[model samples]
Target: MTTADVRTVLTDGDLTVVGQIVHASNATLVCDAQVGDTVVRCVYKPVRGERPLWDFPEGTLAGREVASYLISEALGWDVVPLTVLRDGPYGPGMVQRWIDTVDPAESAAERLDLVDLCPAGSVAQGWLPVLRARDLDGDQVVLVHADDPRLQRMAVLDVVLNNADRKGGHVLEGLDGNVYGVDHGICLHQHDKLRTVLWGWSGEPVDPVLLADLDKLLRRFDGGFAEELHEHITGAEVRALQRRIGALLEHPVMPHPRGDRRIPWPAF
Candidate 1:
């Protein structure tokens, strides 16, 4: 894909931003559609780290914003709109669709008001942890009480993709009793990263129901997942994902790998 060049980004108080939206765990700028029927959203990174090509193949952290979106959309998750936006403020902003995370089944679990929940959010110094602990089962996301199989599928897909931000708040439940996933800007990697309270069920074997879902996902992954990932992530990263998928299918309850890699508390 050709890099998009936009020249009119804005950061006034009136346009829904009390502050800048971001994918801080990975150093990205998040924003909503400023214009368009399609309503483009995005996360952009303008810097290329030294030996930048050695790390995550999702491209520059900013570019990962797009790669993250592509991976989620391909898996059929209801990811927020993610784009490579340009206009004002920062250089390239990763634009993501504004999603309504209000499921009647569950609360949008509170974002860890803690400063270290996300590394990028930590340095950008924009996000301040909520200053209170929250119950994931609380009605902060969607407005429902039971787990939607589809949403569960998406969550499982996230683990396979190595998403590090499956905070209770990020898994939104909708009024229609549907589950919508957001904050995928830090996803799709070759790392063993997997950390979440949702894994209370981890180490427990996959039951037949979840196993069935895996069967379906395996089929889908083999079919279109490859072509779709090729668009944004590198061949090696995509191959790693394929390997990860195989591992999950064989044993669904392994301890999440990357939980230890993240800073549990702020270095600051």
Candidate 2:
């Protein structure tokens, strides 16, 4: 189905819970969104199931997830999958199209993972090293991610959204050959809270094409896109997002980590 059709199903179709994503911190349910004959797999995070967060306001994660999708769409980058805010079986929440990732068993030869670990000092030619540490056996290993353009775009989106919890597991290698980011509940805060694992491009010059996209996004913000974002995030948060875009436009360089907590805990 086309993107529009899939979105319609997610918005209006009946959601039947199939199972729970037990690993998720919040209540994340796997469901089938069915509209007559068409059915699509989706993830439903009902607002009622949200866990309280000390930094972020209560029950606002769903909206932030949707807002992240909006920002990604405005940039014309498909870094995020189709996500929508709607009433579901439990309550109003965020629903998103589930991405089927490239199976490692099937694609091992190609090494499809965007983030990975390797023996210290043995980082692959095309991969960028992020951190070095000891493994369970006390042997040195390094954290690394691929130097791919798609992942770079995601890093840019993370900056714009001020994503606070971009763990390595949140990055998915979709079977369709696209890189996608997910679990954006703690994003778009009024204050700076950009935590991500896609910092491989840090301190590098921003791609000219992505800078152009940021320019377009700034124009949209002036054209009432900020108001639309206000429906999900706060007015101050919207303004903060604009400032982030403006700062990037002015500097046109990928940001370096600011503090010790730049990378989220449990990096995987």
Write down the lDDT of every candidate, Cα atoms only.
0.48, 0.92
Put down candidate 2 lDDT per residue, 161-183, tens digits, no spaces. Answer: 99899888999989899999999
In order, how many clashes per candidate?
48, 0
Highest-scoring model, TM-score? 2
Clashes of 1: 48
TM-score of each: 0.55, 0.97
The true-versus-predicted C-alpha distance at residue 221 of model 2, in Å, is: 1.3
Lowest-lDDT window of 10 residues in candidate 1? Answer: 5-14
Model 2 Cα shift for residue 174 (angstroms):
1.1
**Model 2 ranges with Cα > 4 A deviation:** 109-112
lDDT (Cα, 0-100) at 203 in candidate 2: 95
**lDDT (Cα, 0-100) at 128 in candidate 2:** 91
TM-score of model number 1: 0.55
Q: Which candidate wins on lDDT?
A: 2
